[model samples]
Target: MAALMTQFHVSPSGDDSAPGTEEHPFATLPRAQRAARESVGAVLVHLRAGTHVLTEPWELTAEDSGRDGARVIYQAYGYGTDAAEQVVISGGTEITGWREHEGRWVAEVGALDTRQLSVDGQRAERAGIDGLPDGTTRTETGYRTTSLAPQQWQAPASVEFVYRGIYPWTEARCGVAAVTHTGEHTEITMAQPAFDQAKALYNYEFEYQRLTGPALPTRVENDPSFLTTPGTFALTRSHPDHHVLHYLPRSGEHPSHTRVVAPALETLLRVTAARDISFRGLIFADATWLRPNRSQGFLHYHGSGYYEGGDIYTEVLIEGRQWLTVPTETATIPACLTLEHTAGITFEGCRFTRLGGTALGATAGVGLTVRGCDFDTLAASAITLTGDRDAVLEDNLIQHIGLDYAGSPGISLLGTAGCTVAHNQVTDVPHCGIVAGPGTGTVLSNNHTDRTMGVLADGGGLYIAGPQGDSFDNGALVRGNVIDNTRTPYNFGLYTDYGAAWVQVQDNVVGQADNSAVLHVGPPLDHVVFRGNYWNSDPVGSDAVPAGVTYENNTTLTDTDELEAASSAIRARAGLLRTQEPAIG
Candidate 1:
């Protein structure tokens, strides 16, 4: 007869006029969400532990739901304490007066504007450069390069520029607005229409979209004479109410005992249209994104690079030549814990780290349930999920993350329904480790991908882009996964791209891939279907296996004791079979 639930606690040193119980807790988290919206039936709210910082976002709507069959948790008294009892919900802004200047260190931060910085908790490194110099053209409003002497830098409108070429699967960025040198050329001005609609969404040179790399920006970053690396960091505003940051210490760092951290709110949690909520073992950290630092500049184009209005304009024709291109549900990057149109939500064992964006974002949900979570580093994609329904991402543990978006991907999902990415453990990524766009009854089972495309090339370890339902019993199902490595070089261990339709690739296991056709299937695909998989070569053994596909009886392990007895049961049924602890009190 245990039908009584209504507990509230919250802390960071209690007192929002206490009495939210647990020996009078309730300090913030909106006064324990206004006493759990005036408690009625079921409700939990706990919280406790340390840092709750947040300078904004913490919203929840549908009047913070929990009607019929009540259930509105918000846990974190989790994992029997210890380890400093984690629970951080930070949006950053720690800084503290440092002062040093000559060899770097600075500080101040008041008029703040961030692009991420962490230091003592690691994750710093922004001064950047990495290429872009040889006759850099492209200019109607930006880019001319005669080689950075941009009028002796102080702040070329906060520099930025960084790109990943004309879609080796996109990663763009913008933000500089006026540099002017004109004579030996150096122009630079950008930050408008995000580098003019990211070169009109395809980096000029259309018609087969040529230009696959530098036409200008191969990378650049904030100013201060590009800081000449050493654990980097830059950022400046000078006056208009001050802002300065600096940093350069990386030899036992000691800016008055470093702990740093920057990131000033790019949404630190918002869940609208809520219903039976539930968020256990909390830890949504830092947070970044400021629309590529204003002027809507972050026009990335593919996969999770959802170009922010999802770029359009097509024209195709091919061999008959008529090309113009640009497609697919663009504009991704926006997930620092934002769940919209929620339903019976449930995010257990949560712990999204660092996060400069793309870390736990649910959209138009219904019966969502992300289990055993713990995505790391993150700068993009460690779970995006869009237009959900009956969703259920299982046993999670996506690692490293795209750091600062290189066409990021470790679970991107889109338009799902009856979704279910199981037994997860996507690793180190830079792109594709479970993508899926346009879904329906998807079920990528027993997951496990190692080393992911690392620095992106042509995405790998499970992709799928178009049509996902209307066959294999209502489509999509690439089972028992375990793809060991794809670290670069046009990867794939199951891709299916663009015209992909009604999927089904079974019993997966591709221990190592640099692609000689580790299964990509496209040239405009359709009905797809590969069966009984287990690679080591022979995904059509050297390409040429297209045509709405269908291959059967797969298995190409050229003996190493039959590939270690069939990859030891797919590395023992792939990752985290259990582990989601918390709640000891």
Candidate 2:
């Protein structure tokens, strides 16, 4: 099924007065979308050559058909040509009410499409911009947006003291800048006050009647990792009468001191409800923070498929330095995008890199499929899933993950059912390549891992942590996986935690190991079997002759200490009474 044809074109010198035809096209995308929605079958909206500045999003609506086989499609005509570059709809800049002053346009800083600085109605001097050798201009500089003004330096009589400078955990403390709370509604804005002649002034709310001592009970110092100061403030403010006291921070200081803050998970969920929305071709540098100071999942949709196509290059250089010195903070910073609580969602042909947090984070989805994606240089885990059902993760390349955190895994699966992790390449991560945790009817098959740059922490090709709940029937299968040079700081090629029963480990390959043993099995349940796996740790080849579970035709190359250890772990897990239990319990 298709909607009626709605021809809409955009040009730099066009207006709405023009008819929505190929010759005389509608100038605005909203007009085109509106006209297309009113059509009967389908509307093919075409955008002509030029740039179109948009203040809001343009959403297209499809008409509903009576039968199942009917569908509506809105096709773009000039998507493949430089002439196809005819339409450019942009937002995030505010320019209005500006007259030509000194041969320049004057505009307010309402929104910014480009980073050019402007004065009262006209473009003014710009920072970090210089003329280049080829007569091109470049913006090679950035501003420190986190700095505070100079007047807020002195400490006030009463202040919401946050000392996260250094040694934050031991020195956390909070207090009311004054004895009173004042603001419109629940807001409190305080001014400079006298507290031992400290110039720091605060504006805040104190909901409670009074307290005998300081607002919070902790102290402060100068160190990194500031998890405890806010923890103490929130602890003291748990009472109903306790309220937030606002404090205008000193110059170059933020109002709040949290290491990571991200857009609220709900905002992402709202964006996920649309169809054919793609992030692949856009340069997203300065999007506003829709939500701040919370940790939540990214996106969620109901039976709607999500699409993302894009690339991210870390503007900050991390050659031989710490990565977190940049003031930018996001709690669950997704590289490309995230999809949660969805059905029939698909991710294809995307690139995720230089991420602040996870590359792809998913949870509680059904009929999900991810294909032909590349993940690299992620600060956290590359791909993570939780509580998913009937998902397929296939044909992707994942590498260089956990660059910021040494304990992070490449892929973590928690309570996912009837899913498959297949045909992917994983390397240079800090933890396990694939971890299946307490899930039923899951499969890890035909995946390859390069152990040359193996993770320093525990876990390798596949890690199984089970028995978290009774819902796990141990119907998990691990087969046809390849591991090479996987040097872990702690444990195995395949690790099994508690309640690992009726699981199958077969048809896999392993190359090297570190201090820990390979094929770790612990706190067994019923029939955790290992069979038909190959090993090549020593000069003589050996078969995978695991002792504990029922062995099936498996072989190895050059029996070594690792092979013997694997055999012993199988025996111990098989209840054969070990000489000594493996360290992993």
Candidate 3:
């Protein structure tokens, strides 16, 4: 004995004139969405095959559901062999002025700063030359004297330079601070000291050779005069320390205009929870916007400021403004697809295309999961996660990103934990594959990245910054990962910043790294382990690796440079092993 099931039918062709009862159905998705919001107990809705123009994106909230488990399901079908054309869900509704603020979704970008914002534990390292101690040099020639005998002279000790760079120096800089000679291997212990205002410590452990070979004369200084720009208080160096730096910039201010900047897809998906909401095989097509840039899109979970159901777009477009207008806030227009502070979101099969901007321009979310989705032709990053506690991005394809000349990264996540980014394919991007910021317990495993370069003036790959707290980052793992054609003119296979700890980089394969410097570790990068990692371009016995770092069972296949970078990488990394630890299976 079963209760009779109540049903509501909606056909755009059947009525602009009906009341939408079981006998009389109304037309349009807006009417259906409205009806579903007000109905109860497993409401099944049908759409007749045809094109439906959406002037505004639909919003689904948590309040639409009833105590008896109200449900709304949509599908297209033919009646009595009277088949219509395939249902075409086309035409994007213009969304404006929504941002993912804190752990909640908001329509106003101004509300983003009203919440608590802080860096997470676990440091992320970027390659910039900052925090190296500026040194002074005075030439001194030693001579053997016998009153009037021919005087024999010896080489000088050091040189002087200026300081104008970024912070939390790497190991090569630490070695420079010790002034170790070329071909002379010196090992130094690394440590992380606390910042005045923040909760993290910074530092890397590295090694370098002197200019004793056919290279040019040694230039001593915190910075070299030759590298300094004219009329600027800066100096540069040819050494490896000069190339790598750490970065943590402030998010730009929010715009104050009454008009909306860019709206997110989640904003329209927030139907009331009283209704059982389901987006089954729906298509959102040709989401062209007033702006042409890739950064603009929609925000989810508006007003109540918590989170809502995932708005799955089978196909969608996100563009930016034609002319660059100075934004009042750091968050500008075209920041696409922000899902902060919500759960139970699923994008089973969808395409996110044409995302641009500098940093967090595309794909900002928290507690979100994106599976079997695709990202294409993006200008900046495909995705950015901020303060997400638990998230999963699995078995997806992200490709053809970074159309803008200022290409950023594939994904950048900050202050996250319990996140799994696995089995994804990312290619033709301009920056690193996945950059995890401080205070994140993230696992980036079994992912494949190819042709990942940096922005015009930046470096590339798996840049890890330290957590805001001095305690080392826990559960940051990079395993079974494959990187191909990581062609950076300068930098490493990986970079670990100071105050970052408890990291494990294992069972990974890297190929055709154009740069010789592979793994750059900042001071205080202790308790970090690299095991069974293979670098095809890195020789097992070269100088490419910095000293004092630990490695085990790592094999390098190339060793043809002045530094023997391959051999150095092996020797330096081998030091980190406990010697008797069992090999990984």
Winning candidate number (lDDT): 1
Q: What stretches of model 2 exceed 4 Å from their correct place?
A: 1-336, 452-456, 467-474, 515-522, 537-548, 558-585
Indicate whether candidate 1 or candidate 3 has the larger TM-score: 3
Comparison by lDDT, 2 against 3, better one: 2
Candidate 3 Cα deviation (angstroms), residue 35:
2.6
Model 3 regions lying over 4 Å from their true place: 1-28, 41-52, 64-334, 354-367, 454-457, 468-474, 497-499, 516-518, 521-524, 539-549, 559-585
Candidate 3: residue 19 lDDT (0-100): 70
Expressed as tens digits, the lDDT of each residue in 29-49 for candidate 3 is 777767766765666666665
Q: Which 10 residues in a row give candidate 1 its minimum summed lDDT?
A: 514-523
Backbone clash tally (model 3) = 99
For model 2, residues 329-350, the per-residue Cα lDDT tens digits are 2123343345656555555554
**What are the RMSD figures for all models against the true structure?**
18.6, 17.5, 20.8
- TM-scores of the models, in the given order? 0.38, 0.48, 0.50
Candidate 1 achieves a global lDDT of: 0.78
Candidates, ranked, TM-score: 3, 2, 1
